[model samples]
Target: MRLAALLLCLALPVAAQSAAAPDDMARRAAAQLQQAAAGLERAGSARDRVAALTRTIRAYEAGLAAMREGLRRASARERTIRESFEVERLRLEQLIGALQSMHSSPEALLLLHPSGALGTARSGMVLSDVTPALHAEVEELRARLEELATLRALQDGAAQTLEEALRGVQEARTRLSQAISDRTELPRRVTEDPAQMRRLIESADTLEGFATSLASLPADPAAPDLPDFAAAKGDLELPVRGTVRRGFREPDAAGIRRPGLLVETAPGAVVTTPWPATIRYLGPLLDYGNVMILEPSGGYLLVFAGLDQVYGRAGDVLPAGSPIGLMPGADRAPAIPAAATEPGGQAPDETLYLELREGDAPVDPRQWFRLDED
Candidate 1:
């Protein structure tokens, strides 16, 4: 009887050791499961959440296997230990089921598991001391999730604002392009003949008379530099660089005979004056597609026409050699022999005609330009 009691004592310790191994494994699995749940909640990106969930599944599998192995080796008197393990297994099964449900419905998971859905365990009591640590981890994760959600909202709002601004800029550019197209067509409607354009010089004479009258009549003591005709006559320089194509002549049946020196220039070239002058006129004129008339100090009227673009405006004071406009078109008129054509070859089909005037008449522009001598 004593021998049987001794053998029983030895068997009891062996059974206890076997039970302890499974219990330790179960505790470790529970701790890992809790840690993984917290990690999923705290994860800032999708990849991080997936990794945490995977780790939790591995731990749960290991613990389950250890518990089964312990039960197989346990004795009859230690059946209570086996029964306790069975209860734990059932609890784990329920947890895994809840996780599966959450995985199927992310929105529902977010609502039910604000702490975050787990891969193996969804809802279960861990060891007593472990509960506090698990709660702290969950709270930290909740805070991080809230921050991520707020950032996403702000980014969406910013993208929408930028899209609206880009749309406005596109609309404005379309309107500007349309306006330019309209302005380009203006010259086609105004003048048909060069002779009529020469007749228009009468209007310029009328304007000069008006200017002279105003100069004589004005005198507020504060009014600046009243027009000095003599000073004006000597100070201004020629407006462009080119040879005269037509010289001033008496009016004939064909047209008011050329009343100014028509300067010929290359197409698409920049037009400018050799001296500063105030812009007197800027727009379409008879026989001139686009025109700019500048009145320099000496009653010198500098005229430029046949332009594709105008960079200045009426009343602007332009510096010497400043760009006024680009010449129009690319095709150059074929040069016909002087004897084979009209005296100056002044025809509508010709590509050149930029006239200049001084006071009421035109002068030989060739005499004023020093650069042409070279």
Candidate 2:
């Protein structure tokens, strides 16, 4: 029922412009956007404004993504229906001509066949079957044409809504960023030593070395203990929403294997901490782009690399699902290319490198993270 209401809202005109009837996914997009808007409205009153704004931004992102996929489906379906209609065009024209001739012919003349009475009776039986089949084919063709038109109109009308959704998500992201910068509620797990952090980053030439050095740093004596990391094995969520493009120690194009999982996500997607953890390091290191190293427990580190921007600071303890960073890219909603919008198109543009380490040894992150596989 909620979906139906959203669908009705999607069908309404914007700025005196009529909207096309939405598909199921389009209806879903509408609902998600509505939810995001509601979240945004209530964010000012929420206890944790950053979390509320994060949720709003995520909702907007999900809605925009759905709308994009819906447009792609509509385009593909329209192309298919148009192709089918063209293939049947000549046959349909001939059938229409024959039907018109038969309608104009005298009733007795139509009954008389070039054969004897027995043959005429058989011919009548065949005509009775063929007539219904022909009518059905004509009806099917009509329906396909109508569907094609609807799809085409849907793609046309969806552009404005897509633009609005994109703008809304961007605004939400901006608000979330500001909120995070102003946030100071999280506890500090360690005292940051600029010199020590600089030495670790400058002296280490590899991820393993950097991670090992970070682990040797001391935590504050007064810091509170976090939940057991080992107990959450196989139940932790991925830091970001994406598909695992490569598994742990998986070989790349050059056959060089890394002890991490490569996750492909949409450009500028949000990255969060999946568990309560303290930030040990957050910056560019080695060849792993922008990285955020977290110590969820003693001797256990979760590393997220390839971010566009990092949030919070070293030693700040974050609760689960806290926005830690964003994947590298512009915040604008994607204008998917023709090939990408097609069925079974290329994967998303950005890739995040994730690794879990226990006492300086890399472990299979898939074993710890519950992933939604492609």
Candidate 3:
């Protein structure tokens, strides 16, 4: 019921915009112009951010459903191909043995040494019989070899996919330590009092107002503030391996927009920082659940929200790929039907929201890092 209700609340758009539809990437390109605006602007409201996060989760759940089915089909195909290869190999061996047998026979030896014109004529008759059978064997062997080659390729592809899935899981686990270590860290720049923030939020009408207020507050002096975070832009990587369900500044169904990338991942996936930064704020922020904002560089913030649980607090300095939290339902995903499917109709079960900021200005995250293999 939780899953169903959530899906109904946030209808996912198509995974990849079609040729007929407005190019999603084109919109992304246009959105980049937001950064080019005269000065820094504020982000959207909590409700708007939450709504986008909801849609991201719905899309992810759908992808997870499709991925599970694909893995099943791939596993079955792997078995079938392995079995077929064995069968064909035996047939090929038998064909080779038959040819070898014929080569050593009296009939074949006679062709090697014909007696005269009459003997040559007799040898010709034997050769004619042997040639047809040998040709048939060779043709069959050629076909079997071709089939084996195709099957081998399929097996290699399947192995790669399986390896990718395993790697994603392992990477998530590896980040567990960083998350645990930072759990006790204090808040930076923002007040630890939720009541105070709530009071401030009620008075503030816009996200910009709230963020500005948060910034005006005293910051933790010990939080590692990198002077040269600009150098780490292209070198950064994702916290988890997943598909880009949404790009930075992509508008939602209601036209409410945020500057962030939504990664559709599997349940129980790990979440980490793309680069080293101090945790500015780590707690629930109205609609954005379990938010963790990292300041990788001076004036450049990386925001990740919608986590099941967060392991760090404000003021802690984290390394790149530091494990911070995990998504829900790792044992198994909730039975939520995917709202939108991929090109091959696969859906995933989890969502992670990522956004970048240059001071107060929002920027396109697509320019930041390359994605891992699906």
- Give the per-residue lDDT of model 2 (tens digit) for 1-374: 22223233233322211134347777788778878888888987899999998888778777767777777777677666666557755555556666676678775665566678886786567557566665665566567667777777777777777667677767777888899989978888655679877877889988888888787777678887899989999998878777898999889999989899999877778888989999988988888889999989888999888998999998899999999998877554355435325666653479999989998689999889898742
lDDT of 1 by residue, 207-228 (tens): 3342332223222233223244
Candidate 2: segments with Cα more than 4 A from true spot: 1-22, 103-109, 115-123, 336-348
lDDT winner: 2
lDDT scores in order: 0.41, 0.77, 0.54
Q: In model 1, which residue pairs have backbone atoms overlapping below 3 Å?
A: 232-297, 232-298, 233-298
Ranking, TM-score, top scorer first: 2, 3, 1
Report the C-alpha lDDT of model 3 over 255-316, residue by residue, as the tens digit: 86777888887776667677777776676666767777777766677777778777665566
Model 2 clash pairs are none
> So what's the TM-score on candidate 3?
0.51
Model 2 local distance difference test score:
0.77
RMSD each, Å:
34.8, 9.4, 18.1
